[model samples]
Target: MRAAAGKYRQRNSHAIWRAHAESASHPMSEISVSATSTVDERPAKFSASDGTALTGTWFEPSPPRIATTVVVIVCGAGIPARFYHHFARYLCECGAAVLTFDYRGIGVSRQGNLRKLKSGMEDWAVLDIPAAFAEARARYPRLPLGAVAHSVGTLLLGAAPDASRIKRLIFFGPHTGYWRDYGARWRWLLYGVWHVSMPAVTKVVGYFPGKRFRLGEDLPRQVALDWAGRRRPELGRNVEEARRFRLILSRYREIRAKTLVLSITDDAFAPPAAARRVLSLYPHLVVTHETIAPATLGCGRLGHLGFLRRPASEFFWRRAAAWLITPNVGDEPKTTTQAAQSPNR
Candidate 1:
């Protein structure tokens, strides 16, 4: 596993993404996922519903045959989809095609101008995520579909179209992200960062340089502003705020797919309360919530982003794979909820 990851790091890192503009495609770029050559990872491109070209990496399952199911991975805020390469490859090895793409204004998906990017979480949901699902459905019409999201990715999923096509919805560190959702120890810090510092800094620089703070990539001004002002359902103030809110609420209510919401006990950004708040949005779904302790996985910590790292893949990735490949939700006992935790509480 270490050798495979090393090869991915040396060959297909995000630095390679810098070579091509978002509108350009790397037609034949390929990377062998492991020393045994079990999976083939290739750079691919697709367009969002708005005619915006997005960039992604497609991990093909072994045997080079058509896949019966495809897993689309949507990343957290600031973090690019390339960060989930190993996880995607793992899913591919488990007999599923996986496509991990950057949301607009992020990594390889950031086209022509960086400073003038007008995308936000709503664009990802209504445009990017839905486009990915459409692309996958178009490419493999009869295949079962699955989506795995992290952090804000889950909220984006709640707003995306074609929820009926997705058989399973897997959420990692899902949260509504209101300041009140945070624990006492981190509430003030989150409030200051999201509500105060981010807006103030973005206002001066015209963008938030998240890379400097090791948060992820630098984000567009509007993206940061939207995140900062995400405290209320009214969206505080904006022309499209009401419409975006309605779209998200409507999408969540429309979903009937089975869901698995995973939360790390030690995750400061998405504790049980925070994750459950987002789970509450899908009132008509069969949502199975699991809170895992780091020690149980033999890891020192499993924070909001830790589960995606290679070392912890065995703990969560297998379960994700089973959820994706299963014929039905009941085929796996893990899909059943023993005592369903209500988000209302």
Candidate 2:
């Protein structure tokens, strides 16, 4: 089953690569990492709703105190929980209990003999996210529960109407308008990919090969398809079905939790302009916006992914830490114009 899945992913990835190659805008290369930078702490494993074990690590601050709050880190599409290790560790050291986990059918989650079919989408947003929330709440009932979601994770979390369980939400690089950014041809192609090709491919192959089939990476095909299909509507037949599950503009109003939206000025995926529009949807909610400039961080172009790649990304991490440690103080609204003109930290 794994071999079959691998083969499928290679083919699908190649097709996507071809699509990218035909475009003028070159996708950013995957970031390289130094061996010494790896966080060696072993993650504690917990069982999800289906008894699938989810892996995560707990970072305890020096002289551990009674936990005041707990923060669950939700990663973006196609990236593993480990990708946020540095940020999680930093939060843990600063006295906030942190939990980061992989979605079912992705990362270390057990892949049953069940072939990757059209059904995995139900598991990701419904089972994985809520289960993680339940597990964290179960373990730390007294502490305030908060969520920090990146990219599509934000969309998934935002799609949930009853966000009352979480006291606060920090959305890092949330994807607001993906379809608008891509060309009409690509949008149609993505639609077909998500609604038709992916479900069909998963049903036949027992898994989507887009990323999960990779040697070291454990990204699920369902998540990749959901992400990819947003661009090329032609590839997906059930665009309406996909849109129904999407974080529509109306859904933003239902996010009751105190929220913080963070966007880097150079983020290629979620530009600051689009992010500001997203922020406007949640008028009643307390929102704080900050822009990270590449010059301040001493990096050439601190694009979307670079915020995590460089440890010296103190501009983002420091502000994030301050926000977490400090109370209601950081939850204020900022306009896109203000964010742009504000001096770099």
lDDT of 2 by residue, 218-289 (tens): 335555455545543221237676465444334555556666677666666665544543444444455555
Alpha-carbon deviation at 260 in model 1, angstroms: 1.2
TM-score to true structure, per model: 0.83, 0.68
Candidate 1: C-alpha RMSD to true structure equals: 10.5
Top-scoring candidate (lDDT): 1
Which parts of model 2 have CA positions greater than 4 angstroms off? 1-42, 47-52, 62-64, 110-122, 182-219, 232-252, 276-283, 331-345
* Global lDDT of each candidate: 0.71, 0.56
What TM-score, to 2 decimals, does candidate 1 have?
Answer: 0.83
Determine which window of 10 residues in candidate 1 has minimal summed lDDT. 1-10
Task: Locate the minimum summed-lDDT window of 10 residues in model 2.
Answer: 1-10
lDDT of 1: 0.71
